[model samples]
Target: MKLYHLPLSGHAHRAVLFLSLLGQKAELIEVDIPNGAHRTPEYLELNPFGQVPVLEDDGLVVNDSNAILVYLATKFGRKDWLPDDLKSVAKVQKWLSVAAGEIAYGPCAARLVTVFGADFRADEVIARAHRILKLIDQELEQHQFIIGDKPTIADVALYSYVVGAPEGNVDLMPYINVRHWLARIEALPGFVEFPKTAVGLRA
Candidate 1:
């Protein structure tokens, strides 16, 4: 398996971190988004969306970070990572949606403004980050993981941006449970750290 990614991208980090947690030996191919590498025709052939964190398993190409997590979890991990039962699958899918939607527009967008000089309004994104973070904090206060007792791809899906929110000026300090949840994910076996950027509030 090969993962085409950017070092500082939270989306890419989520994929890479989950791959590590699954103990998969995959090559990391850096995509230089800053240098227009992802916009190249050759790169677009792999992912028409021209995004980092595209996965190639043999000849099969998979784009989108959350999709990659589901694919790899189904292919290699135990039931705990991605179950087959209807209820459990839907539960996992819900958080994956959050990771792609709320989390993306929230913490991820906020970080993009500071770290990559993206044009998004920082205050707006930061508020969105807090809204989602508060919801996550409330959810996590009662459950150890997003779905239940065992950690799933849902947890992996939400980990990166939430942990990296501080870099976006979306402080995690007020959400103690969320902070602890981040620590719990860090303590997981085979855990990998997302490369931090000294920007925003973190700067």
Candidate 2:
């Protein structure tokens, strides 16, 4: 398996970290987005969106970080990463949606503004980040993981941007429950960290 990624991308980190957690090895191919390498015809064939973290495994290609997590967990990871039961599946899907929707526009967008010089409104995105964090932190106060006691793709999907939220100038100090949840995820076996870029509040 080959994972085409950019080191600074949380989207890329989620896929790569999940693979590591599963003990699956894949060649890391750095896509030089800063140099417009992702815009080339060859790269576009892999992902028309020209996004980082495209995975190629045994002639099969998987695009999108969350999709890759679902694929890898279904194929190579334990049942715990993504269970088979109806309710469990639905629950996991819920957080995945949060990861894609709320988290994406919240902490992720906030980070993009500070870290990548994106033109998003800082106040708007930062407010969004805090709102989602407050909700998740409350949910986590009762549950060990996002949906339950076990770690799932839902947790993986939310981990990166949340941990790096401070870099977006979205202070996490107020989210105590969220902080504990982050530590728990880090303590999981075979856990790997996304590279932290010093920016925003940390800067």
Best by lDDT: 2
Q: Write the per-residue lDDT of candidate 2 for residues 85-203, one digit (tens) a residue.
A: 99999988899999999999999999999889999999999999999999999999898889899899999999999999999999999988899999999998889988888899988
| Residue pairs with backbone atoms closer than 3 Å in model 2 (clashes) | none
The TM-scores of all predictions, comma-separated, are 0.97, 0.98
| lDDT (Cα, 0-100) at 56 in candidate 1 | 96
Write down the worst ten-residue block by lDDT for model 1: 71-80
Clashing residue pairs found in predicted model 1? none
Model 1: residues >4 Å from true position, as ranges? none
Q: Supply candidate 1's per-residue lDDT for 111.
A: 92
TM-score for candidate 1: 0.97
What CA root-mean-square deviation does each model show from the true structure? 0.9, 0.8
Candidate 2: global Cα-lDDT? 0.93
